[model samples]
Each structure stands twice: as C-alpha cells, then as structure tokens.
Target: QPFTYTTAPVPALTSLTPTSGPTTGGTTVTLTGTGLATVGAVRFGATPAASFTVVSDTHITAVAPAGTGTVQVTVTTPGGTSNGISYTYSAAPTLSGVTPNQGPTSGGNTVTLTGTNLTGTTAVTFGATPATSFTVLSPTQITAVVPAGSAGPVTITVTAPGGTSALPSAYFYVSPPVLTGVAPPSGPLSGGNTVTLTGVHLIEATAVRFGTTAASGFTVVSDTQITAVVPVGAAGLADVTVNTAGGTSNPVSYTYLPAPVVTTLIPSQGPVSGGITFTLTGTNLAQTTTVLVGGTPAGFTVVSDSHIVVDALPGAPGTVNVTVTTPGGTSAPKTYTRVGSPGI
Candidate 1:
C-alpha cells in the first residue's frame, strides 16, 4: 500500500499587531492567525515586506515595506494566501524650530515647538530627558515644559507613532546669572546715574531693576558686566537685580540719596579778600562734590550727610548765594555776605 500524504491547512490572518506606521516604514508588525509556520511570504498592499520571519504556527513577524497611504497586509503559505488586513502609513513628525530655544538649566519654563506632522506626539525630549509636560495644540505645533538639563546645548526631539525627529539645531541651557557688586552703588533719588554691574553669567540681560522699578535703560557689556541707568526711586536702599534668558540674578543693594538742601552757614559774612573757612550745614551733603560761595567756586569737605566745610572765595562785597553740589544734585542756595574793607 502507498503512504498517504496530508496537505497543510490554508493560512488565516486574524489581525495585525500595529495597524499603522511611518510611510518610510520600518515597523515590525506581528501577524497572528493559524497555520503561520508554513507562511513563505508577507506583503503590504502590492509591495512585499522588507523582511519577514515565521515565529510559530500562530504568529509571523514581518517588517512593513516603505509605502504611502492605507494598504492591505497579507500572508502567503504553501496552502494559500491569508485574507488582507488594513495598515496605514503616516508621514513622520518633523521639528523645524523652537521658540525661545534657550532656557535656564533648572528648566520648568514653557517653550513652543513648531514643525510639520506634529499631531499625536507621544513624547518630547531635551537631550535625553523627557519634557516635564506637553500638549499637542495642532498638527504643526506643540507646547512643552522643559526639563532640567546641564548647561550648554542639547538636541530637542519629538516622537509620534509615525516616527521620531530631532531639531536641526540645538537648544541651549544657560546657567542663572549671579550678582556680585554694583559700581557707584549710590545714586540720587531723581535717578539718571549710570552704574556698572559686575557678576557672572550676565550676558543677554533683558532687564535691570531697582526694588520694584525697572531701570531706565541698560547695556550688557560682557558675561560679567553691564551698565544700567538708574530709574527714579525712593530714598534709602533698593534691591537691584538683573534678568537674562537663564534667570534673574541675586539682588544687590543700591542707595538712593535725597537731593541736598543747604540750611545754614556758620559764618554768613566773610571778607572780600577770600581767606575765610566756614561750616555749611545741609541734608544729603555726604557726597558733596563742589561748593559755591557768592557764585564763586570754593574748596569744600563733606563732613557728613548733613555737614560740609567750605573755604570762602573772593567775591564782590555784597550778599550773594552759597550752594553745594553732590551726586544728589546741587543744593538750594543760602545767603552769604562778603564784607568790604574798613577805612581809617
């Protein structure tokens, strides 16, 4: 009697592991059904798969071929070809740019990412760390909160079911600015004085503030220096700070002195010969730069914020005005009399 031969059962595809993938297609898909061990080939629509491997009688792992739009996936075996299943090819997500591409190393700031095919984003990353949070606003844009990172540049990547893409350029991480000192730390309450700020990581400063008031203007001179014009502020100490892309700097002290006001002259009258020393009393006189007696410039010493000593200069024998000047500005004038010589 001749041995009887049994034929293999026809292959049947019940489902596809992943129903969609990138159009550039390299997606590994699992086809599950019966009689898969004898499967000889797999295809996406009319195009054959990049590769395929028979895992068992119930599973076949296949690499989908590069294609576009929706396509039917099928398996072929010695017995017969399986029924087609649906698979979709999508365009990979791309990153064109990121708004405010630089931020503090400590992160937590929101940034906008612009691109194409960004909808359905599964993840966003700065370097290797995932974003603190993110939201898909449209097919071309996404907003994400940055995660903490080391100082310097890092790649920003976006991932979707279709594929992952990185920005063409790098995003930057900046260290927060530091405040060490302020030159000419004291200014008049009326402001307008230019002061130098010294510190580290001070480049790209966007704002300079005294207490709650913003500086009138500022210039970044280097990574460690800046020049800013003080804005009008109340008398006494104000906290000065600098702001950059990295973050706000530590505060430094700034003093605002009220304008000087001359209230008295110890010797109101002096000889026209101009050889008299006199005490001048006033408020905000500590920084007195000059003294004028009878409209003539006179030598002077700042004894304190309320006192200054002056060496009277020769002037016409008559009553004239005496004034003092300081960083707080010229003082109000007081009367000074120069006596004439007495004849015998």
Candidate 2:
C-alpha cells in the first residue's frame, strides 16, 4: 500500500482596521479576512510589526512599527505571503509658537504655527474644538483658522497619522484690547508731555510708542488706563500705540505743533516817534493778543482773523511784533521798522 499527500490553501487579507499611526510606535491594528489562522508574520510596509496575535482563523491583531511615508502591509504563513495591504506611517507634529494667539469670539482668524514633524497634518483643535480651516504649509509649519470660542485661554493641538503631538504649553485667548481715548492731542517737539490713555485690558502693557519712536516713559496705571511721556519728535501728526500682552491698540493721532513762526512785518518802516499800523503773518501763534518790537509789546489793533494793525507805543526806532491771537491759536509776530519820518 502507498500513502497519499494533499496541499493546503493560502488565505487572502481582505481588510485592515486603523491603517495609520505615529512613526514612534505603539499602535494596534486589526487585520480581517479569511485564512488568518496560519499567519507566520505581519509587516507594515518593509518594517515588521511586533507582538502579533491571531484572534481567529479570519482575524489577526498586530502593533504597528515606526516608519515614514506609505507602505504595503501583508501576512506570511507556511503556505506563502498573502496579497499586500497598504498602511501609512506618520510622525507627530510640534508647535513652537502661534502668531497672535488671541482672536474674537466670532472666530475665523488664521494663525501660523511653527515647529517640527508637521507634515501630513490631518486636523487642528482648540481645546477640543475643531478649527474652521487648516492647511499644512510645510513639514515645519501649519496654518489654521481659529474657531468660535468664549473669552478665555485654551490649548491647541494638532493630529496626524502618527498620533496627536503633545499640547502646546502656550494657550490662546479670545478677547482683544480696545482703545478709548488719548489726552493732550497736541504737544511740542520737546515731548516730555504726560498723556493719559483710557482703554480696556491695558494692564499688561509691554511698550508705548509715539509714531515709530519708542516712548521715553510709560506706566500702566490700571486695566483701563496708561500714562506715558511723549518722546522728543519733529513737528507733525503721529500715531501713538500701546502694546500689551493681549495685542496692540489702535493708533491714536498725536499732533506735534511747530514753535510759533514769524513771517514779515506789515509796515517795513515806521516813524521813530511811534504809532505805526502793521500786520503780521506766521503760524502757531499763542492765544493771547499782544504787540512787541524786538520782544517789546506795542499797542495793536485787531483788524481781522489773520491780520493785526499795531500803533507802536512810545518806543525807540527799530522792529516790533504786530501779533494777533484767537481761541484756536496765535499768529507769528511781524517786525515793523521805525524810521525818523513816517511813510507807508
């Protein structure tokens, strides 16, 4: 009598559960299909997984190994290797910093995150709340829009195939600073003027600046007030900004008026005996009305808004100021030269 021989059939892998995870390791994946009882080895791409267990003739569970990019998964038994199944490997992304971590409650604000292993980011969340929009700019950077949230701080997290990375130490807040008012709209070039600012959320003020020039003196008086000394600056209008931990306030206009300017004298020559009618031209004149010749005040007449006729009072020969003033400001002094004989 002769003995008989027979061949066994090889099993095919039909599906796999949770086909992805971090390259650092530790992800249990389930393989499902017929003929899994005789599985010899489980591999995720070219890297073989560890601690694989056969649950039934049709199912097997294996822990994923650390790797990068995409790879083909398969099972090897005494019969042979089955058809390859695809699995993706990824690394957790990190966050170094978030530009402008604060935003409005209504949300919809784009923020940039910088760090490492940020490629293939699947999602971003703010304290468990999903972001409205997200984009992977590169392996080290990601852009995400803030979702609607309450006024407070919340942790930000990013998720990828490898796994979710550690939460960033820094948190994002919702409320921003609001500017109410600024004092002393106009100041001299010498600065040193103390201007009080009133606003909300001003306690964490970091810096104060007059235009682009940093202020010489600054103090946070309260959550709604800031006192700062204006730095010496040129004549013109400039914006005053107060920066705080929350953010920077809207720029306030700081007017820098030039010193009183002196133009020409109305009457080039006057009688040495005095009483000469003259007008003056210039800018930023003081509000007080007075006439002076070489700094000497002479009796003057207010003819109009821009002109002043002055009758030189018993003064010696030479020039004098024919100045006019109003609530708005003063006019520059005009010189009136006095001659021995009075002539126009």
Candidate 3:
C-alpha cells in the first residue's frame, strides 16, 4: 500500500508595474509573478480592479478601480487568494496659473508657477520640452526656468507624485523683431519721405524711429513689413528701427542731406530784359529742380553736384532775389542786379 499527499495551488504575485496611480483610477498596471494563468480576480484592497487580462502563467494586465490612499493588491485563483502586494492612490494635481508665461524662443527665462498639489513635482515642461531648471516652493507654488522653445502658443504642465497637471494653453513664445533692411533709406533733412521697412515679426508695430527721433507716421503691412514716414532730423546718418510687441529691431542706416546753398552767382549783373545765362556756385545742388528770379521761374540745369547753370528771367531794373530749389530743400536768396538802358 502507498500514501499520497495534496499540494496547494494558490497564485503568487511578486510585483505590479507603476506601484501607484490617481484615486480616480483607469491606470493600467502589469502584474507579474508565478501561477497567474487562470487568475479569477484582481483587487486593490477590499475593492476589485475594473478589468484584467492574463498573458501567460506569470503575467497579467489589470486596470485599477477607484480607491484612496495605500491599498493591498492581490490576485485569486481556483486554489485560493494570493498574498497581497502594496499600491498607492493619490489625487490628480490642479494647476491654477503660471506667471510670466510668455518668453523668447532663446529660453533661459525664469518663470513662476502657481497651483495646488505641486509639492514633490518631478518635472515641468513647455509643450513637450523640459524646463532648464525648476524648484518646488510649496504645495501650491513652483519656479522654473524655461528651456528654449519654438515661437508660438504652448501648454505648460507640472508633474508630481500625483500626476501631470492638465494645464490649458498657458504660455506663449515670441520671436523678437528682426530688421533686414529699409528702402529709400536716405532722405532730406526736412523729412517727409515714405520708407518701407522689411523684417521678421513686425506685426503690431508701436513705433518706428529715425536715429533717436520717432517717425511721423507708420503702418504695419504684415508680420515682415512696415511703412513709415521719415521724420525731420539733422543732416547725417540716422538709425532706422521698428518696434513691435516682440521688441525693437536691429538698425538700418539712413542719411539726411542738408538744404541746397547758393554762395555766389556768376555775372551778378544782368539786363532788365533778362534771358542772360548765369553760372551759380553752391553746395548740394545736383538735385536742383527749380530756379527762381524775384519769385519768377528761371530755366536751370544741374551741371554737377556743386554747380548749376540757369537762365535769368525778366525782372525790374532794381535788384531781385534769386533762389535754387533742390531735393534737399530751397536755398537762401541772393541779389541779382538788373541794369536799365543808358538811353532811357
């Protein structure tokens, strides 16, 4: 005669992936151990998990159910309930706000965050990019230095032992204004020339400047374009700049030309009948568009930047005022003597 002995067939649970989750549940945890092929039920403390699937003799995937605080996770088979493993459930964190939410794409800007359940935060991010640095100030506050981020609106979030905060589109990244060039860069010292400025991120322009002086007027044509009126400035190079929401742009050089000058008039004396050719000496005369004798139009030709030949118009026997008009401006008047006939 022979004697036989009975053995136990209980399931053994060694561990669970993601040992913790939010109390609201819905976290899928993997159970690993021996003798789990025919698991009948998986439980978080006294409550049973929502759903579970057996992969083999040693693996099972289960979705957690609603519960609070720490709980013992266990599995049961036809033999009996298995030994329990520990798991924790915590509340989801809430984010009320983030300070200084807007920053340059170049990053390295410090930002302050305000919210609840922020203590023991493991990470902070703008979009998917992690912060350059961060410090948890308290359960409801955190400070983080943003990493380089792409220009545009983005969501900022904080992760702690509880979970990642579901913050909405809570931050913005702005690209600084950059100026490539300004057309018709040079104008007369008197101002009033329309200039076109081309660049990047030029929308919502608040101001345009010539050197230190603000432009008389401006219009934002696009994110990369702006039209401005040149303002009155001294004769010299003026730095042109555009200011937008982003910031001031790089400078483009503009030159202002002084008013035309008339130093001397050749053959200062002329016949009362006029029609006499006169060679005028002056500075900045190349752009001369008009010549006048006693307020009357006189034909003129710009021989060079410094010289102009003009035909004197009819005037009275006495002296009359002679002026030259150029792109820069009209020159001061000079005396032109008109002689009467000796017979008269």
Give me the candidate number with maximum lDDT. 1
For model 3, name the residue pairs that clash.
Answer: none
Structure candidate 1, residue pairs in collision: none
lDDT of 3 by residue, 1-344 (tens): 89987665789999888888887888899999988987899999999999999999899999999899999999998878889999888777788888876767778878889988776688898899999999998888999998887788888888876788967788888787899998876668989988899998988678899989999999999988999989999987888987754557888888888889999999898898887888999899887878998998888888998899989877679999999886577899998999987993
Off by over 4 Å in 1: 1-15, 33-35, 76-83, 295-297, 314-316
What is candidate 3's local distance difference test score? 0.86
By TM-score, the best candidate is 1
Query: Order of all candidates by lDDT, from best down to worst?
Result: 1, 3, 2
Question: Regarding TM-score, does 1 or 2 come out ahead?
Answer: 1
Provide TM-scores for the models.
0.85, 0.53, 0.61
Q: Model 2: per-residue lDDT, tens digit, 1-344?
A: 99988555577899888877787778899999877888889988778897699999899999988788788889988777889888877767777788777766667778888778887787889887898999999888888898887777788888876667655545556455667878867766778778888888787788888999999889999989999988888877888887765557798888876555557665577677765465555555543355556666666655443445556665577665555443223456555666666469
| lDDT of each residue in 221-240, candidate 1, tens digit only | 99999999999999899999
Q: Predicted candidate 3: what Cα RMSD to the true structure?
A: 6.1
- Candidate 2 whole-model C-alpha lDDT, 0 to 1: 0.74
Segments of candidate 2 deviating more than 4 angstroms: 1-9, 14-17, 30-72, 76-80, 100-107, 149-153, 184-195, 203-223, 227-327, 331-344
What lDDT score belongs to each candidate, Candidate 1 first? 0.90, 0.74, 0.86
TM-score: the better of candidates 2 and 3 = 3
